[model samples]
Target: MHLPGYPFESRWFTHDALRLHYLDEGDGAPVLMLHGNPSWSYLWRRLVLALRGEHRCIAPDHLGMGLSDKPAAGRHPFTLAARVDDLDALTGHLITERAAPENGWTLVMHDWGGPIGMAWAARHPGRVSRLVVLNTAAFPDPHGPRVRPALRLPLWLLRETRLGERLFLRHHAFARLATLPPFGLRDRLPPDVRAAFLAPDDGREHRLAVQRFVHDIPLGPGDPSWPLLVRAGETVAAFADRPVLIGWGLRDPVFDPLMLREWRRRLPHAQVHAFPGAGHYVLEDAHDSLVPAITAFLRR
Candidate 1:
């Protein structure tokens, strides 16, 4: 049975027995779409449908996020750098043996996906043909308030307390989505679709990814991902010659217009479009316009 609006084949690559889930579609240059916290590849469903016919669209569910194996801390390191490694392993598998690089590649990043995906791009600057940024940041801090209070808990408590894991992954994350303006999406997502987003973690062990995402905020130099994010920011600043397009949701509670302004300042040549009514999920709010705009940007 096909998952409507997200009709694609799932492919997995084992990184130390933990299978990671990813979507591979179409037959042209690869367009890698990396999703952020709380949402899985589900966030890119509409965009994949729009672009797959012309370009190969690969969207992955990071280790513990989507259909991928939800291993505990003992099984996997759910840190920001590990996520970047997962992306690298998956992309290398796709390009090295499976497909040949033609037009190079375009990277589409959102939320935490911004840092994880851009980190990989920064490593292989020559392979990055273009970038499409959506309501995400690769730089440090950006001076935003901490939204996920549940993550501030001590790491040991997060792992030992089973109820804490469930509350954060299922209840807290999903509840926030309901509050976003409807934008005609209320009826489109059925019960199962919602469950799929939250289903990876029913037990304490399965909740490691969500917990680590919170704990790995990297606010300062001591944080593991700080150096990688700093490098990514520097790369974005240097890659001003690359064609970049930024679609930002001004009303986003988490990543506000301030972050978008920083991106513009970094990539002064980027074409930016701001959606006032949309929140964090700008793609959901402005997919009709965003899809065409992204398609045109890539086509050029």
Candidate 2:
């Protein structure tokens, strides 16, 4: 879908005092799309355009990202649990008197959305009819033994230290880097499209969620989000018996081949499409193929 053609009107749901911006379109069974850090519901713009004709596409911006109200750390608890609660509240509000009596939503998640969506799914398995895993992780198992463990130190530094604050909040590393090659796209997004991605977290106040999302990465057992991850992982396993689709970007440095292997091991029956040339933003790189596969999965 083209950026200029992203024509859906903005919708909002109030959670406590905060308003979350979302898109609720189309008319059939529900398809809930959750995005990750440094990005917002805009990440799913293309998919939303593709599936809205046949599916009730509901995509929401987490409290601080996208057109949603951006708050500082003091205003909101920027934790994994908080995210789950927000999503729960939003979906519960939408599904009431609307969703079909028997059918539940097909959960599509990427990046941090994986854990947040899975945690909620663990609590309300009956609400999820199908599962779609993008280039992301929901399981509790932390990345790394040797190479990954060593890598954690730098990540921690980036999350905890002043340097991290400077780079992420002040410098806007994720906003600056994600629209570029390797981390975001194998091929760069067009200037306007790239601008759309960066527009949400364009300044320091907008950067709070990006910085907090990095800080909230549960690196070990002691991390606050670790237990949440454990529960989320069980949900991922439970969905293995249900229809699951794994669309992976092979060149993703974060959720790389090792990550895909673990997912395959757990959900052997899943329909997977691994894109060789794609990076972290698999949808952008592999849209031609992944979109059709996802539409077919929803159809089935």
Candidate 3:
């Protein structure tokens, strides 16, 4: 299903016996967009339309997140490593099929996309030409002293207990709040756009990935994903010379000023833009300024 203003056709690729959904638009240098939990390629629709005239835009819905096939319990493991591998497989196939640009590619990432995309970028540094980071963290820095005090309770509920599964999969609480205003968005999302993000995970089975994503957060050395996240941090930090654009929303409660500061600390050369009026969804909040900045960056 397509959003009203986003008229691009949906494309599919096979990975690990599952049919993954993605969008391939326009041509030239490739702009690979990876989304976070409870969101999909639909998150990058505006950016895709803005740059598709001169750039190839590839946005994928992590399996079970968008129109991609959602496998049942025994079918797949929704871990951080699995998400990165999905991206690797998708890009590998695109390169083989001549869909990827001949040269290195640019990445546009947000939320969980930050770590997932960075994980892939970490492994394939030579193929990364540039990066556009929006309200996401590639490393596990949230546990530091800068973390919001109130954030702990919700995280504990969502990450360490059955409440997360019940709330996300059964009640659809996350999707409902995410697609509405007051969270990632400053204003209420358009009906079609909200629906597009929610439609793919309308069922418990399809929503499993959403729950698992929260559960996968590596809070400490004992966490399952901690080692991988540390590796990703090292890899991302090594690409300091690559052109990087960090667009952030200062109003975001989750990835707030501290996260931006962390990014600045890591990628000292990145061009940073912080939007005070925006929230977690920087694209929706500051796309007017963001699109132009990204286009100019690509041209450079």
Candidate 4:
């Protein structure tokens, strides 16, 4: 779909027999931006526009999300490991296999990107020069005091029950709700922006990834993605000395202040800027302030 103000050239690479889409803009040191579930590379449009003039901004749509080809669950597992491996393959196709710079790519991530990008960074810690962590997590911390019971009950319903499928797949409630009050832009999100985010998952087949993502949250040791996430979380601390920036929205109910505190604890040297009123999609609410701050951070 033509994202109204986002007009970057689209690039595609084949992985697991499906066409994965990404944005490879400009020419210089790479700035790899990874997005979370339900959101795609489009989440980084403003950041990409800000940095593409001086850096190689690479943002990929995780298999089932964004403009990428969405295959059946049988064809693509939609697990965290699968998502991370897709990133590994994309890196090989874009940077590693192509004789790109040895290291110095800035890893920019949000939401599920936390685990996916951190998994990649864990595999090749020496290659990443910096990290720009938005409201995301590489590890599952159940002990956080802010883990609200109010949000947990419904999330469990979404993950374990068929009601979620009816709500998300049949009614497209997740997409509709994401664009509303707490999850997305604080103000009424532009109609075009909402359409662009919702367009890719309009069909039942297209919505499979969204449903699977909701189901993939690794809550415990038995979960399939648990080990990988644990490893990724451990790996997050390896880059403590590297330049890091944490931009967060204090109002995010899922990844709340506790997550930010964990990040600060893990990366004590990292710079953090938290917005009190911004929701999960903090960039939409604080882009004017954040983009410039992030831009300066990148340039420095």
lDDT string, candidate 3, 163-261, tens digits: 776898899898788766677788887777787778778778778888888888777788788888888888888778889999998988778898899
Predicted structure with the largest TM-score when compared to the true one: 4
| Model 2 C-alpha lDDT per residue in residues 1-300, reported as the tens digit of each score | 334546888888888889999999898988999999778888888899999999999999999998999987799989999999999888878867455333578999998889998999987888788889998998754454333764567687787688888988788886788779977789988888887788777678788988888888886677899889878887787888889999999988788888898888888999999999999999899999999999989988
Candidate 2's error at 22, in angstroms? 0.5
Q: Local distance difference test, per candidate?
A: 0.77, 0.85, 0.85, 0.87
- By summed lDDT, which 10 consecutive residues of candidate 2 come out lowest? 141-150
Error of 1 at 261 (Å): 0.3
Per-residue alpha-carbon lDDT of model 4 for 50-114, expressed as tens digits? 99899999999999888999888699989999998899998988765655576889999998999
Q: TM-score for each prediction?
A: 0.86, 0.94, 0.95, 0.96
Collision count for each candidate, in order: 0, 0, 0, 0
In the order shown, what is each candidate's alpha-carbon RMSD?
3.9, 2.1, 1.7, 1.6
What's the best-to-worst order under TM-score? 4, 3, 2, 1
**Candidate 4, clashing residue pairs?**
none
